[model samples]
Target: MVQFRKDNILDRLVIVNDSSSEVEGEGNRDDHNVGTCIYCPGNEHLTKPAVLVLVQKEGIVRRLSDTEDNRIDDWCVRVVPSSNPLVSISANGTYSNKPFYSEPAYGYHYLLVASREHCRPSYIPAEQWSNVLVALQDRVKWLYMQKGVSYVAVYMDYDASSGWHPNLNIVTFPYMPPLIEQEVESINRYINEAGLCPICNIVSMEDKSPRHLVSIENFTALCPWAPTYPYEFWIVPKRHGIQLLRMTQKEIDELATMLRVMLGGLYTALGDVRFSMIVHASSEKSRKQLHWHIEVHPRLVDKHGLEDGFGVHFLSVSPEYAASKLSVASRRELAKLVGIT
Candidate 1:
C-alpha cells in the first residue's frame, strides 16, 4: 500500500511506497587509489588549467590561477574547466522559434577539487569545507556577472565505486531550469498569499518536528515532509537569503560546520552510501522571493516505471522515521566534532 503526499510549497507529489518497511543501511567504505586519479594534488597536468586556486603561505591564503605554462602544486583548493563540458563558450547562440525550437547550449562548466586527497570515506573537516565554500562563492559570483549567464548550478555526486574524490560540479545555464522556475513561481505565490517566505515558515515549523535533524549556528538540517528519495534531507539557513554569494565568512563557516556534522552523521548512521548534494537558489531575476537551500538525496533504490511515467515518486521510508534515526546519530556526531556535549 502507498500514501500520496504533496510537497509543502511546490505542486510536487510523492507516494510513500511502504510505511512499514524498516530503513535498511546500504554502503561500504572503499580503499583510496591515488595512483591513477587525475584530481589528486600532484596530477594537475592531466586536466585543464585551473581557473581558480587557493594557496596558503605564511599564514595567509592567496588566490591564484593556472596558466598555460604554470600549475600551482601547493594549493588548498582548485577549480578547473571540465574536460567534457556540458556547455561551451564558443557555441553559436542562435535561436529559432520553429516547431523544433532550439538554441545553442551556451554556458560554462567547471570542476571544483574540494580536497587534496584522492578518496576517503569520512567527510572533509569543517575548516576545509569552509575553504571549499569560499571558492565556490567566488566562482558563482563571477559567473553571475557575465552577460547572458542566467543560472549557476553547484552539486556533488559521491559514490564509493566511482572513486569518490571530494569534488563538485559547477555548471552555468543561459536560461532558468524548469524546476527552479516552478519553485520561483510557488515561492512568489506563497509570499503574496501568506505574506512570508515559505522556506522561513518551513524552518520555523520543522525546527521542533520529528523531521528535524540538527541545527547548527545559523543552519538547520531536516527531512522534508515529502521526500523523493529514502532518507532525503535538506540543509537550509535560518534566516531568509537568496544566494550563496551573499554569505558572510561567519555564515559560510557555520554552514560548513552544519554540512560536516550532518554528513558525518549520515555516514555514521547509514555507512558509506551514495548521495548527491545540490544547491538550490533563485536566478538574479527572482532572487528577492526565493530562499536558497542545499538538499542531500541518498540513492538507496532504483526507480520503477510508475515513477518514470507518472511523475510520482515512490519512497520506501517516511521522512519522520528517517529523521528519528538520523537526528540521534547526527546529534552525537555533532557533539563529538564540536564538543557540544
Candidate 2:
C-alpha cells in the first residue's frame, strides 16, 4: 500500500521550466513568450483576485478595499495570489511533534504587480512609487495573521531590459528559514558580547567608511564588508526598527526613494544586469533587538561547485571598489533625472 506523506525538503517546492538560458543577459529579454504576459492589464482574469490593490486619485494613494470586480484602470498596484505558488493555502498538517523529518508545507504566496503597465520597479513613475511600497507593507501585515504562517519574505526580480517586466513576490513560511535563524542567533551572540546590535554598529562604521554609497535622511545603502557575492549591496533603515509594517508613511516614502536611487545606480553602472532584491525583518518575538533592511544581490558571477559544496563564496569585486563605482554611477544618473546638483 502507498501512503501520503508531507515533506518540506522534497515536496511543495516551486518548479520552473527553465528551458531558456539561466543567466539573464540584455538580449535575452525577448526570450519570454510575449503572448503569455499573464500579469498584463487585459489578462486580469488569468489569475486569482487581487488581495490588495492601491490606486491614485487627486494626487493621493489609496487602497481599493473591494476586489470583487477588478479592472485595468482600478489600481496602480495589485497584489494577488501567485499563479505558481511554492506553498499552499490549505492547512494540511499541524506542527510536527516528532523530532522531524517530514511535515506539510503550509504557507501563503502572493504576487505584487507594482504597475498595471509593464515596467521595471526602479523606473516606475515617481508618483506611484510610494503606493507600491504601501501595498507591500499592507499585504505583509495581513499575511502575518494567517494560520500556519510564522515568517514572511518579500522579493522582487528585475531584468535590465525593455521587453521583460519585473515583479515582486511575497511568501510566508510555516517556520523560520535556517539562514534567518542563524542570523538571529548571531545577533544574539553579538548583543551578549558587545552590549549592542551588530547591524547598527556596521551601519555606523560603513557611514564613516568607503563602503558607504548613498545616505538619505531615513535610510542608507552600503556595500557589506564580507558579501557572499560580487556587488552585493544592502539598503538599511537608520531607525532601529524590526517589523517593516511598523514604518510610518514618511519612512516608507524614504525607503522607496532609496530603493529607486540604488537600483537606478546599478542600471547606470552595469548596462542591463539582472538583480534580485529582498526584504528582511524580525518576527514579533525578535523585534526588540533586530533591525529591518533590504538586500540587493546583483548576478555578476555564477557560484562554482566549491562555493556550493563547502558553503563558501569567493567574490571577484571588493566591497570598497564596488561601492565607489556604484556611488559615482548612482549620483550621475540621479542628478540628471532629479535635477540635483
- Local distance difference test, each candidate: 0.79, 0.71
What is the alpha-carbon lDDT of model 2 when measured against the actual structure?
Answer: 0.71
lDDT of 2 by residue, 310-338 (tens): 87889878999999899887776557656
What is the Cα-based lDDT of residue 297 in candidate 1? 91
RMSD of 2: 4.9
Candidate 1 per-residue C-alpha lDDT over 1-341 given as tens digits, one digit per residue, 9 for 90 to 100 = 32223445553533232422343211111221344666777878777899999997776778899997898999999998875565667666445443435456667878888888756425698888888999999999899999768989888878866554688888787777667877889999999999999999999999899999999768899999999999999999998853578899899989888888888888888988888899988886444456989999999888899888788998879999999999998899789888883
Runs in model 1 lying further than 4 Å from the true structure: 1-35, 285-288
- The TM-score of predicted model 2 comes to 0.85
> After aligning candidate 1 to the native by TM-score, how far in Å is the CA of 89 from where it should be?
0.8
| lDDT for residue 332 in candidate 1, whole number 0-100 | 91
